[model samples]
Target: MIVLRNLTLRRGARRVLDEASAVINPGEKIGLVGRNGAGKSSLFALLAGTLHEDAGECLVPSVWRLAQVAQEMPETAQSATDFVIAGDAFLMAAQAEAHAAEASGNGERMAHAYTALTDAGAHDAHARAQALILGLGFRMDELNRPVNSFSGGWRMRLQLARALMCPSDLLLLDEPTNHLDLDALVWLESWLKRYEGTLLVISHDREFLDAVTRVTLHIERGKLTRYGGNYSDFEALRAQQMLLQQAAYEKQQAQIARLTKFIDRFKAKASKARQAQSRVKALERMERLAPVLAEAEFSFAFNTPTGLPNPMLVLRDVDCGYLPPVGASADTPPSLIVRQVSCTIAAGQRIGILGANGQGKSTLVKTLVGALPLLSGGRVEGKELSIGYFAQQELDVLRPRDSPIEHLTRLAHTVLPEGESRREQALRNYLGTFSFTGDMAYQPVGTMSGGEKARLVLALIAWQRPNLLLLDEPTNHLDLATREALSVALNEFEGAMILVSHDRALLRAVCDEFWLVAHGRVTPFDGDLDDYQQFLLDDARRQREAEKRARMQNGQAEQTSAVRKREYAAARQTAAQLRSLKRAQEKLDSQLHTLQMHKQAIEARFAEESLPVDEITVLGNELKALNEALDAQEERWLTLAEEIERIEAASS
Candidate 1:
């Protein structure tokens, strides 16, 4: 457990926290909520011992451990497993020391060292480490890869995996879900649900916090207030709190007015003199409460001009795709071909392309935009044909040396052609409109995050306000809050959009039509993207049910082939072998428990005997080894339990 005893934090001239006291109890999962610069990260760092509170003590038990996501990369190369193992560094060091003592002719020290390492789970700690590593989405083959080879995002994941590996009474996690994908987020949510230790996490991911945390500690205007319930419930309760505060303020003001009138009328009277002074003191002492504004939200609305051509883009007997460069053609694709393929996209057409990986949805868009040449016959037409393309192509068009503002300032004039002076001023103001406030406007384009860079590029393009929007996975690397803002903006947009995205929710919200590209052909469908999700789900369900029925009826109609019979027998034998192995593991675990406890007993006796400091140190080594062994056995049991549960569930 960890306790923040009257903590005070300041940022420059601002008081971010003032005498805030909070307790994080064991097994309690908490969500830290606050606006930007409300000291959430600072508080987390303080808890992690990476930052000083300046005023109050953070009281944490010696056994309490904290884990934080590394926003920056470490110097050395490391793999996913290496990252998690780093969390076990303390125990690993103890292990090495225990072995060294045994070699140095100190039998008591050797015995004590062995016990401490064993108790700390050194015997089979690798399996525990691997399990924790795998839970965070590491492939078995990636265990040995250098951590430096990973991009910043993957490095964050490695940092997170290591944090999860650390067994601590209390854990503080900051923005834990920022780099996580939906699937990994779900897994981590489930893991936290079953975690026994106390945890406090600062995350912008609503669904994640809702699923995992029980307590919401909302930081508003540098004040800490705890709310009971999940995030949605917290929001509702916060709204009620705001309303009540306003009501109280109004009641106080009304009474103050009455007092003012009474004092003014009775000012000349002797009794009124004391009463007026008292009222003035009350007014002076009253802390006037300011209203808390709602979170910042983006407003999205755009309209297409009338008198547009129908069937704007069309392809006939054309293959739309590109192959990697061949021979000396550095940037040229081999070709993209569609045989007897015909397609037409008209004004007001909202389409989504659905296909497996490696399908040419992006290629089709490139061909339409003239970024890729059409291989066959096609006619494309649009009235005044203005288009805005937001691709996943890295937005590498921005010159790295130039500031974001400088690049954007140049693009506006170049793209608009006749904008000249007035438009440049409006464009500068527009960049500020999208959070490029003052100094941020001058930050180098290369220095921005992927999400920020994408938004900046989109801002420049949107300034022109084109008729067509071609977006490809625009939500990648964006935090959920930003994604929500983008959603609102897209909803207000009126231009025809051709979107290719893996986000079902986004596609459902924005699209009115669906397009499927496969085998170099185009298939158009009526209705919205929700229909596509339904179709996919329904198909998957039907396939699953069909497989279940087939499996059940296998013996009735078709006897198993000899090859299948052999496979079944092999599976049964493997299951039996695993069961036998599980029993042996349980037996070994029981014996190991006895050994570790005996070692602890010896160390405790040594501590009570008032021996020399060196003798006590020898006993301490034994205790450390004992702890490691216990951890290792516990880890083994967990793995066996999981394996057995899975096998039983699958059979059932």
Candidate 2:
């Protein structure tokens, strides 16, 4: 359990939490939400014990094991699997001790060390870590790759997987879905649902929070408020509360008005003097209800395009990818990530691109937008066609040192016809429509938050008056409010759009059709997001089965038919033994669970300090016996697992 009592926290001179109090019970899944600088991360730091409160107490159970994703990018030569496995401190420590014991030739120490390893589930740790890696969208082949070989986004996924790998009592995840695709996000949602621990997550993804969290904790105006149910529930409840508050304030104001009028009209009359004095006292004693202040709202729309071009673009037998940089060998061919792509995008078609990560969704979008040259096939564009493209990496489109006004001005210079260029004041007015006004228009792009940068990109796109928009993960850094605004704008857009995003809410709101990019092929997918999620699951299952088959077929190229028959028979016999051993292992697991529960109960009683000395001694001895028995069972379980692995390897 965690408790924050009258907490006052600060970051430098700014107060983040003022006289705030909240309670988070064990096993509760909480979603923390607020505006961009509302101090969600600072609260997480307080819980993690890295930040101290300026006043009041933040208490967390001393015995609870907490886990959180690392903020820094991991730089290491360790294999991905090894890095994930290292998350389980107990397993790693046990393995190290066992190795040391074996090296020292200490019989008793080796026995204890091996027992500890088994208790830590070291035998299955690799498989568990690999499952986490796969769920986070890492291909099986990439598991053995060095951690340093991955890009920053992929490395963040690794960090999330490692955090999930830990055996913790409390898990804190902040924006875990930032770099994940729809497929990986779905997998993560399922995995988190099955996590047997308290979870506190900070996310702007409403669908994700709705799926994973049962409670909502909102931070506003330096106060923490708890609400029952998910984000949707919180929104509904908050609306009702605001309505009631407004009503109460209105009623109170009416009463005060009547009393003031009565006192003013009858205060000098002899017959009504007593009543006027009473009314004055009543007004003086009455507490005034403050009117509820509504939250600030922002709305922006995309500018109407100058023209709508039917059959906006057509791709026939297209090979989409990037070419080698200049000065490279002429023999080097264009590297195609997607091939044989053929489609026609018509005016006002809102198409959502769906695929797993690294499956060429972005590449296809870039090719269609003319950012990359087509290696082969024809691309036909309609007359007066103009495009506004948003890249997934904001840096690819935004100038670091330039301000928003400068970017828009430069764009106007290139896009505007002669004698039609807008003045500086006019450009700033246009920027203001996207929420950039005054000094914000002159702020350096590099100094802006991700949400600010994304908004700036949208502002730039809107300024061009393009007939088509190609947005690749445009909502990657946007908050929920900004995402909502974008969705509304896209719905009202008069031109065509192709969006490659993992945001299910935005996709559902803006797109009417879906196109899938997979296995170097582009095709129409006749389904919704739910169906696509199932497709990804089915694909992952097939991938795992294929890997199993490949492992079985390893090193058997020259085997004769008779040898194969013998090996098959041996495999069947080994499988039978493994099944029997697995049943025994299950029974042992059940017994271990029971014994551990009983031991915990005993320890709890012992901690009460009310038990007699003799009784305490008896409880301690019983716990010792239970531990010994559990250790023996664990050792046996490990042996069975090793034997099964050996048989499977030999059969292969």
Candidate 3:
């Protein structure tokens, strides 16, 4: 357990936290959320004891071990397992060596082995190590790979394994979901849900908070408020608070206006002098609610080209990857990361691709936009399609030296190239829509923060209202407010979208489908991710049920025959698998039904739209493009029929 009393942290003139008092109890999960500059990470550091608390007391249990992730890579030459087994590594090595020596049956070595094993707690260490390794995605084959050989993302996984391996009562995780794939993330969430220890995690991930934590600790307006529920509950409470504040502000303004008028009228009259004096005193004594909190401005407008398609994109057996380099010598092969990727995204379809780090989501997106080369594969057909692509590494695509205004200007030309004066005006108006006013628009892209850079990217993309939009991990390091804004804007837009992100809440909010990835080569599961998860839970339930049933059937589990035990185990496993498959098929059926309804709705709307507006004479090739999108979803549904049979059979 940890407690903070009257904690005040300041950075120069800015008072980040003022008189903040918080208590973290045993087995309580707390999610810390705030704006970009709200010092959530700074608060974590203060608690970690890496930074000094200028004003107050931090009471922590001495035995409460804390692990906070280091943003920077530390200098170390240890292997992956060595790094993960960092806590008391020497003892583990000594015990392993001692056990090996004792197995040889030598008297002197046996004496040494007994001393080492007893000191190292080797009797129970094997079980402990096994649980930790298996939980963190480690297998027997990968137990000894060098840590330096892995990339930064994989290195983070090693660090997390180390944190979990140590028997710490308190876990302080900062952005644990940043480098994790969907499977790893779900595992981490499941662990925290059942963990007996205390956790204070800082994350902007909606689903993570909703799944793991019961209490929401929000940092807003230089103070901390503890709300008694998940993110959705906190949001509802905050909305109520804002409404009260707005009503109070309005009432105060009316009272002030009335008092001022009375004072002016009575100041000149002798009979009302006492009343005037009292009124002035009252005005002076009234403490106006700490200067009304200003709402941050956000601006951006869509400048859509008139002649665009209804069906945004179409892919056919497309294999794509980044080129190694231009003009390279012979005997070099291109990196073909994505193989046989095909999908037809129709208007109003919000699709999200879920997968691990290297699983061709980005590659597929790049190929769709013509940014990467398509290998030997099928054709993608959709003419007169306008696309707005936002890659994860936006810095690579946008010029670093250019200002936000300059970026908008370039995009304006790309969107509407008919006239010069109208294009300039369009750029200016579009920038205004994304909250970029006069001088702020001139800020260089290189100098902006990650959030600012992402906002600018959105600004540029909205400047040209494309029929198809592609986004990659747009929620990384973003605050909840900005993400909510994106959710609103996307939901309102009349276009097709393809997104690649690991944020579960964002997926649930924006994407209608595409939970599974393009193929089976990326991250291994028990099989499919959703199916695997269902199977795990079902198996556990069945095992527990079978044990209970065996006890009841035999009148005593301890006295049961070996043949009966074997029979129960086999039946339990089979029953569990069938149950999981049955549930999975039901879910797929529901999803398919929803997809069909949405497609029908789209058709109904298309039929009712003014046909004269989409006339070939008026709209040119764009009308033909929109017509094809109407049939694409139906075709996709037909292809899924065969897969449905496989699911149904497994369940049976």
Candidate 4:
């Protein structure tokens, strides 16, 4: 158990926690939430034994092992698996002891050390580490790659995996989902649910907190409050409390006003002097209630587009991926990731991109945003098309040396019309709408927090008044309130949108359709996010099984006989057949969907009273034809799907 008794903590001159106290029992999963800079991180430091309370008691069981993700980026040549396995301190210590005993030529000591190493599960360490790595969105081949070869974001993921690998009674995670995609985030949620330890996480993602935490611990105005249940429950209960508190305060103010009026009128009169004095005494004895101040509200909306271009952009058989390296030959063709993706973006259409990490979701988005060149196929834009893109690494586009006002002023020059005012004050006023005000507007962007940086990028995008928006991981650094505001703004946006995000709430609120990028193809996802999550889990399970089988095969003696070669050839043929059938099934499914939609549209026209008898007859006949086509496509789709299933079953 951990206990805090009237704990007071400070960072520099500011008191982050003032006489705040809370008790956390062992094995309880707690969510530590607060507005940005509300001392959540400070509290985590206190628990991690890095920061001491200024006064009062902060206690944790001395025997308990603790684990936390390291903040510093790792720069090592060690293989990813080895780096993760090193997280297990106990196993490492035991192995070191065994080595030392063998070097000393002490048989008894070596035997004891070997026993301890086995007890620590040294034999399965590699497997466990690899599982954590793969579950965090790394490919199987990346397991042997040097840690430093990965990007900063992937390195952070490795750090998280390392923390999870450590054996601990307590685990502290801070913004764990910041670098994860939806697939990895879902996998992490499942993993955390099964962890048998006390867990405390600091996150601004409401859905994540709701999913992982059973208890909510909120830090506000230097006070710590613990609530029973998840973040949603805490929000409901807190809102109710605020309402009651406000009501009580209003009633008290009314009573105080009445008392003052009575005292002022009668205090001077001789006959009423005693009564006036008594009223004054009553006022002095009353306990004053403090006004309930709401948290600072932050909201912004996208400026309505000057023109709504129907079918803002079209990608025709586009092969989307990365271009060759800078030093490579100019004639070299781009490496294709998603092949032959054909999609149209119309006014008011909202599309969500879903896929496992490294499966071309980002590649497709980059191509659409015109940041990456198409490997093949042509891209068409409407006459009045205007695009605003928010890349996953949006911060890289910002000039850190420039202030918000300077950034906006430069944007105004390029985006705003000539007649529009580009004065510093006007730009400052505009920046204020996104909560950058006064000196903060003039503050250097490099010194701003991640949330502030993200807000600035959004503000820049809004100023464009684009009819089409492409956003990738836009909510990564935003707080819950800001995310809610963004969701509301997006819902009201009349522009077409393509979004790639790990935030399920945002996806559900903004997307009208979903496109899945997988296996070098872009296809429509027929179901919702829940279905996508289940698909990822199933895929992960299958991949693990395949890896196990491959390992088993590798351990066996090589079979070079003609019979074995023939068997392998037959297996490859079956696999190719399965792939072809799946592609055919996808095509038929798309055809069926189109026919069904056409049928529904025609049927809906029959309800119109303005339609004449002849028109109704024509619509009825067209609907019948659509239904027939739909039935035929559906039958073919089912047959192909069944064949795919059969092939899959045989392979398994």
Q: What is the C-alpha lDDT profile of model 4 across 1-652, one tens digit per residue?
A: 9999999999999999999988898878899988888899899999999999999899999999999999999999999999999999999999999999999999999999999999989998998899899889999789999999999999999999999999999999999999898888987986886677899999877888888887889898999988766789789978998999999999999999999999999999999999999999999999999999988978999999999877789999999888888899879977888999998888899999998777898899889988898889999998888899998788978999999999998888886676546888778888999999999998999999899999999999998888899999999889888999999999999899999998898999999899998899999899999999889877877887787779869886665689778977998899788778777865774576467556646766887679998998888788888878866886776677667666755775
lDDT, candidate 2, 305-421, per-residue tens? 999989989999999988988998999887889998889999999999999888899899889988889999999999999998999885556898999999988988886764545
Q: Which runs in model 1 stand beyond 4 Å of their true positions?
A: 11-14, 74-87, 98-152, 261-287, 293-408, 417-425, 428-432, 435-458, 470-483, 497-652
- Superposed by TM-score, candidate 1 places the C-alpha of residue 18 at a distance from the truth, in angstroms, of 2.9
Would you list the clashing residue pairs of candidate 2?
Answer: none
Each prediction's TM-score against the native? Answer: 0.66, 0.82, 0.72, 0.83
Best by lDDT: 4
Per-residue lDDT value at 103 in model 3: 80
Tell me the deviation in Å of residue 76 in model 1. Answer: 5.8
State in Å the error of residue 469, model 3. 1.3
What lDDT is reached at residue 590 by model 1? Answer: 58
Candidate maximizing TM-score: 4
Badly placed stretches (over 4 Å) of model 2 are 96-112, 266-274, 417-421, 555-652
Model 3 regions more than 4 Å off: 74-77, 87-141, 290-305, 320-338, 396-402, 409-429, 437-439, 518-652
